[model samples]
Target: MINGPNFVKGFRVTKVKEFSLTKPKPRTIPVPQKIPTQKPHQPVPESTYRSPKEQEVLQGKKLTNRQKAEELLIEANMEQFKCANPEKSEKTKRVLSEIMREEDNKMAFNKVKVQHAPMKVDNVPVRLNAAAILRERALYQRQVEEELSRIEKLVDGARDPSEFLEWQRQMHARDLEKQLADIECRRLEGKLSREEALLARQNLIQENKKKALIKKEETEKLMRVYAEKRLQEEKEMRDLVEQVSEGHKNTKQARMKLQKYKQQIVQEVAEESRELLRQALEEAQEELRKKFELIREIRAMESVPFIRQTLVDLTQTAGHGLNCEMSIVELRERLALLKEAERKAEEEKRDQILEEKQLKQQHLLDTLEQISLHRAAQAKAAVLRLEEKKSKSQLGKAAIANNDRVTELQRKLEEKMTERKRQAEALKLNAQRSTSKSCKNSYEEKHWKELEESRERQAQLLQYGVVSGETANRMAAYQAARNGTSQAYVMPS
Candidate 1:
């Protein structure tokens, strides 16, 4: 019993409360109400009528420390030890220590305590024994159930095992037929030639044959596996039945009867399955025949001229020799020979036509060459005549409109040369005067201003003395030749 710090205070210490069991008071009974007459009786839900204690638990009210201790004590007593003092017994002490350790672990490690109501026995489902039920059932009902179970097992995960394979085969066949039809359509549309169409058909037939063989093998393997599993299951069933029969040693007649009924059922199912397989095969064959007939009609209606001609030749050449007595291989070989001969003949004819076309083309090319030469000669003569007339006209115009500006040009050149000479003399006098009067500060702004002013005056005089356009152009060309730069030609306005 540990004392808290409050016990040392001057004020009266709060006494530790001791745990005590209190007697419960009698609960008051409620008065019953009379039933209603007109309205329909609605049943109240069980949850609404739950006891207060159950309601408190459902509301997630946690137990206090004393209450938890009381629960532990009660659980300890419920172990039912034979010792006079259960609290002092070794097993009791061990159980209490284990419970304390678990509680301590829960408190120390488990942060979350999920509060939930215990599941009731009424909520648990009752397990049934299938064998017991089967044993109790009548023979006729049992047989029916067995047959149904066997049928369900045969179906497994498919719609019906008997029909699934047939359906898959039919679907595969339809897909193949559709692909063949598309190929034929492409051939008719000229997307594929006759040889390509034939090759595609042959490859498709080979693929179909291979797929059929694989499917047959797969089906055979599946049947073998199924038979093996069935045998194993039957053996297991027989062993189980023998074991059960040995326990009773009196149901031999019933067992024999059941076995005979099962055999009959199996034989009947097998016959029905075979009949269904035969019917599906016949239906599929019939459908294929109808589809082939339709295909033949469409092909005949849409046959190309070349194909029709080839067929006609084949019929005319080999029709008499072909008989029902001939084997397919012999017939095929004969047709192949006829086709080969026809191909050779067609090739020769094509070659002859190509030779004739070459001859005609050569003749036309020679004729065109001669005509082009004659036209070219006439064009050359006409061009020469036109050129002579143009030269003559150009000479007459030059003589009529000749303007002799050489004298005027010479006069302008002399004036420009005199003006340039005066400017040169003035620049020379300025340079000599600047040199004579040059001080240490001669490169200063004042001296620069004077030099710039003289240059501006010289430029003004040169602009005023400008010559005619022809003379200016000639002077610019001459200056550019002398200066080795075109910059002199780009003169200021």
Candidate 2:
């Protein structure tokens, strides 16, 4: 007479109670109590004793499973008071039986029957009513039929109860196929468009690559031509520099030679002037000695007296070959002649020295003029060398500018190639993304169909009961899985 909801709740409560009753108790190991020892002064009997193994165990030694079993058996026998005397054991068993029988009787006496409150119809008289019973059964049957039809409609998700779920499954499958076909078509179209674009891009890249190659070749050719020209110009400049260096060396040698020549000329002139002066000095000294000798002879002649004349005659008479000294006026005449000769010689020497000095001055003036001409030539060569160096520097600057332009062109070309490669990779990535999206869409459609089927199956299980609905579905799925069949998801009710 209980309602369905209440019955289910009571059934769950009963299951919980049964589960709790059937649960296993935790296992425990029973240790024996330590035996008391007697005093050392007292004598102990062997009959009231402990075994060695029991003593060891009491002292806290570990035992194996079999040893423990053996100990338990011994403990059980001792607790029962089993002894070697059969009569004593029989008497103990009889006493225990009597005590158990008395306890049973006491427990039976203690138990009392519990009384519950009576129901409303419990005191009414029973009457047989066939028609009423049949009508109640019919009502129950009608309700059962209605519930079955409602469950069928819910499971099928259709207006007509008679329609099989297979039709709906077929319709779902057709819709899935249509979606797959559409997706496949879109994927194929996208693939074709991507391929065509890739092909076009490849062609464009090829054309650009060809153009770049041609440009690079032209640049290389121009660089080669410029390098050869620069090399030729450098060779010309080296040759010009060598020639100028040789000319400078020659000019320096010429200047040094001229300077040596000028030094030699000056040295010869000075030596000749010194020799002429020395000769004139010696001539003057010889003239002075001749004048001194003449004056002395004149003084000796004047010093002779008249009285000394007699003595000179007497000496001449004695056979001496001495002649008479000349007179003073003759001596004076001779001295005057000597002085005149000396003066004439001096005048000749002076004329010669003056002519030599004029020759030396002319030689020095010529040397100075030659040195000035050489200096002018050297200054002109230096001006020409400076002009050539300026021209060479200008050429070097032009070559450097050309090299910079070529390097810039190469850098730009490399950047363009890298940009094209990046764009191609982006295109490939986009194509991959489209294909992945199509695949994901197909997988989602298949997953959605499976979800719908699982929901239908769960709707069918609703008729079993609401409380056990999920559990029954889970059990069915587990059984199906065990049997190697396809398992469906159980939708939550």
For each candidate, what is the lDDT?
Answer: 0.64, 0.67
How much is 40 displaced in model 1, in angstroms? 99
Candidate 1 per-residue lDDT, tens place, 1-493, comes to 4665555547786899866657576798988999867988789988777776875764443344446668879997785442122237577889999999999887986577777654333245534344433333344355568879978877786355568887986676556555544443343333223334434555576588679989999999999999999999999999999898788877778899999999999999999999999999999999999999999999998775553343333323444564555555677898999999999999999999999989966765555555456557669999998997687556544543342343343344456446545655665686677677765366465645654464455455557875554555555566546545452333344
Estimate, for each residue in 35-72, the C-alpha lDDT of model 2 and write its tens digit: 99876795686756857676666445333544666988
> Ten residues in a row with the worst lDDT in model 2?
80-89
What are the clashing pairs of model 2?
none
What is the lDDT for 238 in model 1? Answer: 96
TM-score of each: 0.17, 0.15
lDDT of 2 at 145: 90
Highest TM-score model number: 1
What residue runs in model 1 are displaced by over 4 Å at the alpha carbon? 1-342, 365-369, 372-376, 396-493
